[model samples]
Each structure stands twice: as structure tokens, then as C-alpha cells.
Target: MTRRRSLALRLIVYLAIAQMGGMLLLVPITDFLISASGMAPGWEVAPDDWGEHRIYGLVAGSVTRAETGEAILEPSAALGAYLETNPQARYAAFDCSGVVLRGSSRELVDALGGLDRIRATTLKFKIPGDPDPRARGFLRRAPAASGACAIAAYSYRFAWDDLFAVAALFLTPHSAAVVAPAVLCALAIAWIVVRRGLAPLRSAAADVAAIDVNTLHRRIDVEEAPKEIAPFVEAVNDALTRLNAGMAAQRRFTANAAHELRTPIAIMRAHADNPDDAVFRRDMKRDIRRVQTIVEQLLATARFSMRDACADVDMDLGEAVLAMVADYTPLVIESGRRIEFEPPSEPTIVRADRWALECVVANLLDNALRAEPEGGVIEVRALSTAVVEVVDHGAGVPLAERDKIFEPFWRRDNKSNGTGLGLAISKTLAEQMGGSIGVDATSGGGATFRIGLRKSVVAPPIASFGRVEPQRAEGSVGARRGTA
Candidate 1:
């Protein structure tokens, strides 16, 4: 890209050029005024014999007696005497009748085509030279003391070369050395002023950059901003205010929706679980349980989506995993699947909300059980103090679909039994707790879902609990009962 010139530099250059041009114009006008005033009264000379001779005047290059056309002084001798006195003069002559008296400069007289070619009025003309030249002349006819016609004509040559030379002085390196510093100083002052003027804009930009969903309440300080930009800043603050209100409304809607659905889903689950007919009870319970899972996932998603929803509580990773696995173990076994828990011997403590961590672990176990085939194994293992992994012996998630799996309402197979929000909620919960969750292919032919949490320095207290084993009756798996 072409670099643009600075505004201050451009302005300085334009102004300087205009100033120099005006100065140059004055040069010619000054010279013209001086020439006009100098030539107004023509050169005069008196000879010793002219007091009684009544000599009127003598025309240049003409020899004549005053008023008689009698030859007296040769034009050459008379012109030589005048030029000897004023050698620098361009034209000087006295004319009487048809005879003309010329200066000693023969070259100038020949250039003006002798005094005969000279007009009896002021005129300007170009002088012949290698290149070009010009001159200005004035002629006047006056009366002498003897009543004879006295004519005097003077020509002033224009010094165009000298004029150009004077003009060029201002365009030289020395002139640049003088003007450049002044221009630069002006530009520096302008830059400092401009930058200071825009300081408020820079501050506003920084404030705008800092704004996010969490800091939506912050606004640009319109009063401190420059007047020209205050309106724009105000508009931006207004937009942020509107956006904050919209987000608040969305959050309220999600919370209200979750709250409104919880009671009905709980009632449905209780009714489905106590049906008289065993087959109807079993099917209704499964459907109601699916609805319950959907409701829980929706609520979890809404809860974790909030910017301020994080609870700064430390939790035991092993305990959270063990509890979730224990809760889902009975359901997994009832569905003809087996669940294995391999928690660490020591408490794996991490900084997170207990409920959010439980939600993430439960969602992972639920997804694993749903993916596993009949008689397949679901392993819940604490891979590290801060990481818990769930490995299932079922068709693993495809490489291309792994990322999409964590998106809300995105199902690979569109299974009616799954809400598709389970993994999404798990991801949100993990992020809210400053953790991460991801899926990978299992070694054998299943998927392994890993959850990484921030490890806590403090260890959690241990509690004793009895384990439950699955019971089989008539080739159908029964719910495991836990005892104290």
C-alpha cells in the first residue's frame, strides 16, 4: 500500500508554497514600479555653447544645427559623450526636428533599429538573443526654451534572468534548511495537539475492548470524550445497554422454563414408577426417566450458561465420579449393561462446584451406558487427580463428529431416547468450573470421554459407603440395592 502523507505536512507544504508564490509575484511588481519611476523624467545635459545658441535638442544619430537643420555635433560623438557619463543607461537620446542625438551605446541603438524606428510613444518589445529577451521604452515630445521641438526617449530592458535568479534563491537547499525546520516544528505541534485531542477516544476504545458478556454493565464515559465523538460513544453505550437487557431476558426465560417443567416431570416419574402392570410400569418408567434426563440436562445447560453461575467451592473428583457411577450403575445393569468404577485410593480434590462436577460425571456415564450394547462394559476411572475418564465398549464417536457432539441439540444418530443436550451441558459445566471435557476413541472399539478439572491443593475427607452388586432374575437384570 502506498503510504499517505501526514495532514500537517501537507498543510505546511501548501501554505509555504502559497507564501513563496506571493513573494515571487511581488518581485516583478517591485521591479516594474522602480523602472516606471526612474524613467519618468528623462536624462538631461547642457553644453557651454547652449546658453546663447538657443539649442533646442538633438535627435539620436542625427547631426543638425538647432532649428536650422545645420550639422553641429555628429550623433556618434554626442552619444559617446552621454554614454561616457552614464554607461549603464539603456537608452538616452534628444531629438530636434528630423535629426536625433543617440547615446554612445551603438549596440543598443542598432538593436532598437536606430532612432528612426523608435515610436513617439511608450512601447515594450522582445530583444533578439540566443534564447529570449525583452525591454520597455517611453518617448515624449517637449518644448525647449527656444520654442523648438525637443524629444527625449528612454528604454529600460527587462531583467528576466535576474528576476528568475532571485526567485530561485528561495527554492535552494539553504532555503529548505530554513523552511524545513519551521514546517517540521509546525507539524510536531499539530501532531501533539491532535494526539492530545484524541486521548479520550483511545481511552474509550480501551473500554470498549474490555467489554464482554460479564462486563456488560460497564459503559463508555461520554462526558470525558471529545465533543465530536461523544455522540458515537453514547450510541455505543446505548447499544450495550440494550444488549444487556436482552441477555437478561434470555437468562430469565431459560430459568423460568426449567423451573416450570421440573414439578410436572417429577410427578410423571413418580406415577410411572408405581404403575400396577409390570410391563406397562417398566416401559412408562423408561420413557419417564428419559423425560427426567432431558429436563435435568436442560436445567444444567441453563445453569452453566450463566456468566456468574460459577460456585467457588472445592470438590473431590474421585467422590464425585464414584457417586455418579453408583447412581447410574443400577440403571445400566437393568438395561443389560455393566458399570465398573476405578476411583483413586486417595481423595482427588479439585476446585469446582460439587453439583456441576456431579452433573458432568453423570452426563458422561449416562452417555456411555446409552452407547454400550447389551452386556457391554462401562468403565469409570479417575485417570489422574484432576482428570476423570469414562470408557465404554460401544461404537466409538466418529472423528469428524467428535466436536459436534458437545454442541447442544446435536445428535449423531438422532436417537429418540437421548436429548442430545447431555454432552453439551457437561461441557458447559466443565467450562464454568475452569475445566475442559473432550471425547476420544477407545483402544478397543468404543469411545473414551475425558474431563479435566483444576486440581486443588487441599485434600477432601473420606467417607465409608457400601458397594452394590447387580442381581439377575429369570435372565433379566435387576436393580442393585446398596446397604449401609
Candidate 2:
């Protein structure tokens, strides 16, 4: 998979480059204004020159031109004479017309360099044709053609090369400060625009990725999402709605068909057995009962499995368990298994349907009775917060079969004569009631089946009236008779 570049780093890089670029252009703009407005007297500026300036000063000595493409050397001889006359003649230059023709200041003229290095080469050839305003004023001549550069060259010393070198350094870096912020601002604006524009795409992708078959009945709440993504969300939700409706119709048809077939099977089984054959009749009756249990469990599973569409209310879980126990006592006792129950001291109210909670308890008790050996004990306990546990002393199920026990028709031993749907039905019912059921190892060394239900918020009475009469703490209600 290809990785994406980060928006922040890209923003920083682009902004920095833009800032540096703007600074480059800013330097020339600033140079034009500063040099133009700050011109001084004796400075010669020109029309065709764009933006360059040069200035000159007063005369201290003179030089006469000679004809052999060379100077007469009068200024050198004069300078030698002046040096002899005064030991303190420190620096000098020959300014002629509007330009400096020669100089004696070592730092200035040596940097400008020797006579042959001066391009125009002679005293007569090196002057501007017309003086600029500042130059005309300084020279005191309307036309600067007659003198200033020559007079100033003989008078004072200036480091022209040094002045230019220093100006270039200060000007460029200074221009960067003035222009960088605006360029950075523009780039920042661009980044915000890009990120904001892409937000809808990100949200739509998350919504699409989050969709699943289990949640197909749910639609994205597009009114609460970004406007740009509303249309796509609507389209996806429409597709999901159609798929869910078709699936729901198919399930309804299958359940209805199965239910229709059950009545005919029951009628056929009733006619198949002859009343005269006692043994055959008893076995046929048991088989028919088994088939009836299986059909009832199937119907219950299908009804409760559509949990998302069901509405539940608060129910007394303790009462629900007690009712099932009372109804199943005959069957349990007939099987020769001792069934014991521990009711909570307080009402254990939970959020669930009364019928659903009863079904769950009935299925669990039935499983416990069947699993326990004849004359063995089955214990039931209830607590606050709607928790109930039914335990049985039997050949406990293997660890590997625990998970499979909750799957439809998954019997550990096929010869046990069970429909194998009890636990599976109980699981579905518990989940529908917003609860859970599982088997855990009992502290007393048997398998304890636990049913956990949602706790209620209201304060419950200490008594709720459906409990059986009190019995001894450690002894069965009828231990000698083997009744619990």
C-alpha cells in the first residue's frame, strides 16, 4: 500500500519556499525606493542608469592631461612635492568631471586599482555629459560637465568598493523580513482550504468502512453529517434497506412454513401408535413429546433472535425463576433427582419480558434435571441484580464441548434422547432480554449454569411472595424421602 504525505509537513515546506522566493523579489523593490529617495548633492544619477549613485568631494591638487595615451605625471610629482612639504598628507584622489579619474587612498584606489585597469584610460575621456540635480548643486554648475569629479578626486579619500560590499549584505537579508509573512499567510490559507475540502471524503469513507450485514438495518444519519456527503449516505442507506427487507421476508417465510408443517407431524404421530401395544405406544408418545419440544424451541429461537426489533420492560427475575421451578417440580422429582433452590432475601428486578425470562429459567432447569443422575442433587440460587444459577451433580460436560453446547442440535451423546436445543434456546432468550448464560465450574465440584440479567435501578422490597417455604440451611426439605 502507498503511504500518504502528511499535510502539516507539506504545508511547512511549501510555505518556507514561498517565503524565501518572495524575499528574493522584495530586495530589488526596496533597493529602487531607498536609493532613489536618498540621493545627496555632488552625487551623479543618470536616466538610463536605472538605480545607481556616486558622489564626489572638494579638490586638494591638480593633474594636467598629456597626449601619448598617458598622463603627464604632474599629479604624481605634485603629490611628491606636497608629501615633502607636509608629512601628514594621509589620503588623496583625482576626481575629474563627474567621475573619479585616479586616487591615492590605498584602501579606495588600490581596490579600484592601477591606471591601466581604469577602462576609459585618460583624463579627457572620463566624464558624464550632464549633471543630475544633486551633482549640479554640489559642483555649483548648471552643467556638471565642467568639473566636480576632477576637483573631488584631488581632494578627499573615499572607500567606494567597501561602501558597496557592506550595502549588499544588509539590504538582502533585511528585505526577507518584510516579505516573508505575507507569503507564509498565503500558503497557510491554501492548506486550510485543502483540508477542509477533503473532510467530507474522510467521513464518507469511515461510514462505508463501518457498514456490516448485522448493522444493515441502520442508516447513516446524513442530516447530521457534512452536506457534501449527504447524497452518498442516502444512496448507501437505500441499498441497505432493500437488502434487509428481503432478508427479513425470507426468514419470515421459512419460519411460517416450518410452523405449518408441525401440526401435520403431530397429528400423524398420534395416529401411528396402536393403543393395544402398550410398549410401542409409550415409546411413540415419548418420541412425539421430543418432536414437540424441538418444534417449540425452534419457534422460540426464531422469535427471540430478532432482538433489535423487540421491546422489553422491567420484570421480577426472582418470581420468574420461582414460577418455573414450581411448574417443573413433578417432572424433576419423578426423575429421582433432588432439586434445591436458594431465593434472594430481596426482590431481584431486571429489564426483560416476563415470558422471555420464564422461558430462559425453564430451559436451564430442564437441562439441569436431564444432566443430573437419578437420586443426585440439583441446586438453584438467586441473588439481587437478577442473577440466577442452577447447578447439577452429574458427569459434567467435557471442557472441549462447552462452546459447542450452545450451537443448535449439538448433542455430546446422541443416545441421550434430548432435542439438543435447550441450551441454544436459552442462550438466544438471555441475549434477547439483554442478559447472558454460561456454564462455570461449581465450587462444590459440579457444573454450575449461570444466568446473568440486567440490574434494576429502583429500590426493591425485601420480600416478593413467590418463594417456597423456608427449609434447613444444610439439609434437604425432605432428605430421608430424597426430596429437595
Candidate 3:
């Protein structure tokens, strides 16, 4: 505001100076032109010729040109003439020899500063015969005379031109007295107008100052906000919308995880209360472990949500699948099921986080091993570019339950001990590792789980075991059961 005021004042000052300066400069120029042009005879002309103009005319009846450069004039005539011509011109009148004109014309000289009081004076000639009393003041006398004088003494009258010059000069200083007040008034008016123009900015600042975090739900109303701030208001509204969505997602994940944990704990509790049956106790322990597996899967899914898939490294898909299959060897034996691991002729490397890749493999194997009937065969195969398939010879998942199986806390059969987060966690981990989990056709019968990871070009050793070495030929000494 101060800067703006200074600018405005500078503009006003420059404009006023330019205008006033132009007007003041014109006075002297006009005076010089009029004087040089001789537009009108000066007030020193003879009375009869000049007529009854009240303020100007030479004095009548008392003048003689001396023979020897001295002007002899009647004091009254010279003084009156000088007084008449310069009503506006200020002066003191003196005689031909510098004596005061007193007595009858005394009032005129008295008004100008009485002659008796005059201590110092300059001399000039006065023409008593001229109509202009102002010019008669110029009359002056020579100190000595000679025969046939070529010069005269006369008193100086105040000419119309001189009067004009005096008036113009005085007005310059006096006019400023009049002009200063008006300029100040105009400046006050300008300040008011500037304040009015800035009112909108002030009001907008007030509105912004009142906003706070607790009031984020409130919107800046268009009627109350300035038009220039509308975009900022819209952006703030959009941010609030995204924040609300993120909060809702967090709430949903928390609720789902809680529900998923309840089923496993309930199953473990049920099994502990049935202690009398040893065979049933063994089955209950298996179910307890299954519940624990599902809980672990939930924890893994939660952990995966906290990070991104960019952490993935290049890994061999065939090797990861075979390793998971071998880890489930005790379960395979306990269930009286045969398992076989098959990989591509070449190593199928994929870009993925290795730990997440292992989790996905482990979950799928758990699911397959749980569902297989006694004496059933489980085949693990790696297709091109990190695609892994786990197939089990059991009743295939119903079409309606396939998607449901990937939801937390859902189960397809009452007899199963699954907390139902295994497939869900596996699906989430696959996606995080830049892969996908889905169902495919089993080789001949049963359910097949397909996991696809990002493909890489590098191949593994030609005859590497990955995780599973070939079992001894079936029915041979110390041969373990296997299925392909």
C-alpha cells in the first residue's frame, strides 16, 4: 500500500508541476511580447488625447521643458499625473528635483509611504502635461542649464506594462496559497478510491485466515470467496476427497483382517477340547497347523501392502515352484499322496521379489496338498516365462467358489481347516511382485493353480534339481512315491 501510494502521489505531483509550471512561464513571455509589440500607447500620453480612463493619464497644466536639460514642473500637476496612472501600481511620487508632492496630492503619496518619511530615492522626469499621472512621476530636473539644451529631466510614471508585470509576479507566490489546499483535497480523494479498489483482497485474506484442519470438511463458498481464489478452493476440495478415500480403504483392510483371524482361533480351540480320542487328536493337530498357515498368510498379505513390487529381483520360476513342492514332502507322505515336479527344458527366469515368490508358491502348494484325496497325485509344472502350475487330483473347485476362495475368511468345504486367506494372500503377493494368480485347466482332472511372473531370458543349469530330485523308479528299493 505504501508503494502504491507513493506512485500515485508522484503522478499527481508531476502533473500538477507540469500544469502549474506551464501557466507561470506564460506570464513573462506574454509580458515581453506585449511590451515589444507596442500594442497600446503607455499611460504617459497628453490628458486630452488619452481621455478619462480613471487609473491612467498624465498630469494637466504645470510643465516646461528647460532650455538647458532641466524639466521645470508644477508640483501638483506632476504628482497627480503620477498617482492617476498607477492605481494598481504601488509607488512613492517625488518632484522634478526629488522633492515630495505634498498637501493636496498628499493622500496619494501618503498611501504609498509619505514623502517626508522617504530617506532614499532614485530620480526621473515627470511630464505634468501628459494625461497619465503615472507617467508624470518620471519628471525630473537637470541640476544646471545651458543654452539650447538637448536633454530633459522628468518623473517616471508607472506604465500599464509595468503594472501588469508587477501583478503577474505577485500572483505567482500568492496563487500557491490558493492552489495548495485544492491539491491536498484532490490527493485525499485519490487515496479513498485506491482503498476501495483493494477491499476485495482484504476480504479474501480474512476468509483464508479463518480456515483450519478441523474445518476441512467445510468448503469455501463461491459467494464468500473472491473469484481469483476459486481454483485454490477447488484444489483443496480435491485433496480432501482423496484423503477420505484413503481412510476408507484403511478401515476396510482392518475389518477384513480381523474377520479372517477369528475362524483359525475357533478351530484350534475346538480341537483342544476333544482330548480323549488319540487319532482325532492327531487330525486336530494337522488342522491346527493349517490354521496357523492361514494366519501366517494373512500377516504376509498385510506386510505386502506396506511396500511396492519394485523390490523384486530376477529369479528362476521353475526352481521356486519345485522348492515349495519339496517342502511339503511330509504333508504329501502323511496324506498318502504322490507328488511330481516338472519344469521347462530351460530355466524360466522371472523378475520378482524372491521372498514374495516363495510365499506365493508355498500358499498354492498348501492349498493343493490340503485338497488332494488319499493316494491322489499332485503335479507341479513350470511353463514358459515364470508361469507355474500346481495341479491336484481331487474334486475341482466349483465355478462359483473359485473367486470366493481368494476372499478372506471364506471356505469352500466345512471339513477344511483353511482360514481362507491363503489364496487371497497368494494373489496379493503375486500382484505386488508384478505377476498374477489364476486358475487353469488340470492336465486331465482336478484343480490347477496358475501363477505368472515377469519373464527373463537367462536359463538355469540344464540338469539342475531346482528343489526336487527325481525319485527312485517306482517299486524299486527305498523308492518314494511320485506323480507327474
Candidate number of the best lDDT: 1
In model 1, the runs with Cα more than 4 Å from the true position are: 1-277, 459-484
lDDT of candidate model 3 versus the reference: 0.58
On TM-score, who's better, 2 or 3? 3
Clash count for each candidate, listed in order shown: 11, 8, 36
- TM-scores across all candidates? 0.43, 0.43, 0.45
Q: Note the Cα lDDT for every prediction shown.
A: 0.63, 0.58, 0.58
Q: Mind sharing the TM-score for model 1?
A: 0.43
- Candidate 3 residues 1-484, lDDT tens each? 4534554456567756765655565654565456555675682233221112212222323334446744444435544555566343323224434454322244344433433333333233333345655443321222232111111223333244444444455366678776677666765776676556556556655655775654545554556545765676667667766666555545655675466557656766776788666666667767677556756765685675676454777776666666676677766777677777777656567888878878888888887877777767677788755688888877787787778877755676655665566787788888877788888556566799998888865555455433346464331111222233
Candidate 3: regions farther than 4 A off? 1-276, 308-310, 397-420, 457-459, 462-484
Candidate 2 — which pairs collide? Answer: 93-153, 94-153, 95-149, 95-150, 95-153, 96-149, 96-150, 97-150
lDDT, candidate 2, at 369: 75
lDDT of 2 by residue, 1-484 (tens): 8999976668667766766654664564454445556665343432212211122211232333446543222445545654465343233334442344444344333433344234342221122443322222112121144222322121212233324433454356566576567766877887787687667667777776787867767667777667766787788888888889857754654564465456546755665655566566545654555566666776775675554444677766666676677677666665566667677656767787777777778777777877777777777777765789888877676788888988766667746645566787788778877789988776656688888888877666655544455444322332111122
RMSD of each: 20.5, 18.4, 20.9
